[model samples]
Target: MKRQFAVIGLGRFGGSVCCALIEQGMEVLAIDQDEARVNKYRDLVTHAVVADATDEQALKHLGIRNFEHVIIAIGDNIQASILTTLILDELGVEHITVKAQNDYHEKVLTKIGAERIVHPERDMGVRLAHHLLSKNVLDYLELSDKHSIIEIIASTKMSGKTLMKLDVRAKFGCNVMAIKRGREIIVSPQATQLIKEEDILIVIGADEDIKRFEHEMFDE
Candidate 1:
């Protein structure tokens, strides 16, 4: 079944989400106060409209509550985002995800019952910092503050070692969830699978343990 989405605020963040959802074959209603932004995405989404999201009547007229998920991506205007989220919650929208400008904004959204909150800038910064600090780490995603999924290049020392020999789970408290080499990907790689140099290992574990594994596996 195709899920319906309503994206309010046609800023960079919201616009990207709208486009991505459309690409995935989901129905999207793109809303923005700026006419130009709405026009830009008019053909891309199922519907595009220029309206202030903080206006409850405008939202109601658009049948926003019918959407499975609504993303509040109002940039800069924290007040507008909060008010819009509050109205969506009141209207019983099934799920609401909000983009927060800061900690205070996130707290306000949490109090108002936003289902999820994203800090895109903060997350990007963390990923970039990790990549710069560690040559082996290609990408990092925070599942929580404590746990993460990381992609790292297989080190020379691990080139011929298998999962059973490394004892990753028992020794480092990490798991190699997948292995990617060139165009091939192996999901739930076997215990006997060898780690070849240049192969990318997708590892998941607590943040501390992941860091420890990185240091031990790829110390330079």
Candidate 2:
């Protein structure tokens, strides 16, 4: 069965989520107070409606509680975001994801029982900064506040060495979860897996451990 999702506020982030969810074959209901925004996505999504999500009666009329997941991506307007989230919670929406404009907004959303809160702009900035931090650091994914998964392009120093020889886990506490070589990807690479120059390593560990591994392997 296809999952059902409702995205409130058809701004940039909400619109992107709607598009992505549609691409994944999920049934999405797009909502916004702006008629133009609703009309823009009317044909693209499963359903699009211009309604004030802050209105409890409006939400009930739309049967918002029926969706398995709902994302409140209201932009800039913290009060409306909070009110919508509160209403969704009271209406028994099982999973609620909210986009927060700032730390204060995030705190209020958390208190109102939002299951997930995201800072898209801040997160993208962090990812971009990590990409710029090192030439070898190709990508960074935050798993938590302290842990991350990073994709690093192997250097000449790591060439001709096996995972066992590198002893990365013992020395740096980071795990090389996979090795992407050209067109092939080796998931859960063995300890004896050979490391080749330019092979992309998917490493995961605590932030500090990842930093230590990067410095020793790439910086030095």
Candidate 3:
């Protein structure tokens, strides 16, 4: 059977999610308050409707509870977003993901029982800032407010050292989860594995510990 999804609010984030789900061959019901926005995705998705999601009756009319997953991507109006999420929770929707505007918005959504909350803009900004901070830092993913997983390009100082020799966990309290060399990736690399220049090291630890590891291993 085909997977079913409903995306409410056809803004950049919602529109992108709708298109991506449709591309994956999932049936997507695209909802928006703007007629023009709904019309734009009408042909691209399984269904498109202009409806006020804040109204419980309209949501029931759309059979929203039947969908396995629903995304609330309302733009700008935090009040509307919170109200819509609360109604969906009360309606017994199994999974609800809401795009949060800020920390306070996320807190409200959590209380409303949204299964997942995303801060796309804020996350992207944090990732970009990490990229700017160090040339060796290839990418970063925030696991929580204080911890993250980061990809760092191995430097000359680290090129010939084995994992056992580096003693990263003992020295810096960070774990090297994997090593990416060329097209190959080594998961849970053995302590004897040799580090090579340009290898991508996937490390996970608290933000402060990661900073310390980077400074001690890579900085001059």
Candidate 4:
């Protein structure tokens, strides 16, 4: 069976989620209060409807709880967003992801049982800043507030060194999850595996430890 996903609000973020989910061959229901927005996506998604999400009866009528995952992407209308999330929570939705407009919104959503809260603008900025901060840092993915997984291009200075020789766990407190060389990727790369220049290393650890590793390894 295909996974069911519902996205509320037809803003940029919500619309993007619908498109991406549909691209992945999943069933997506696009919901928005604006009839135009709903009609625009009618042909693109599995289902599209215009309804006031804050209305509990409306959500119930649509069987919102049946969706495996629901995303509350109402922009600007913080009150409506909170109310929608509350209704989803009350209905015992399996998973709820909400887009937060600010820190206060995120706090309120957390208190009301939102399973996931994303600050896309702020998160993308942080990831971009980290990429600009180091020559080796290719990408950054936040695992949590304090932890992250980073993809780093190994430099010549660290080439020819095996994982055991580098002692990343002991020295930098990060674990190498995988190493991508050309077209092949080594998952859970062995400690005996040597890192060559240009190899992409995927590592995960506390954010502070990751920063220390970057500074010590390439800050020169």
lDDT string, candidate 2, 76-182, tens digits: 99999999999999999999999999899999899989999999999899989999989998889999999999999998889999999999999999999999999
Residue 48, candidate 3: alpha-carbon lDDT: 98
In candidate 3, residue 154 scores what lDDT? 95
Worst lDDT run of 10 residues, candidate 2, spans 211-220
lDDT of the candidates, in the order given: 0.94, 0.96, 0.96, 0.93
TM-score comparison, 2 vs 3, better candidate: 2
Distance (Å) between predicted and true CA of 176, model 2?
1.1
lDDT of 3 by residue, 1-220 (tens): 9999999999999999998998899999999999999999999999999999999999999999999999999999999999999999999999999999999999989998899999989999999998998899989999998999999999998999999999999999999999999999999999999999999999999999999999999896
The digit string of per-residue lDDT tens for model 1 on 1-220 reads 8889999989899999998999999999999999999999999999999999999999999999999999999999989999999999999998999999999999999999899999989999999999999888999999987999999999998999998998889889999999999999999999999889999999999999998898887896
Error of 4 at 45 (Å): 0.8
Off by over 4 Å in 1: none
Residue 82 Cα positional deviation in candidate 2, in Å, after optimal superposition: 0.9
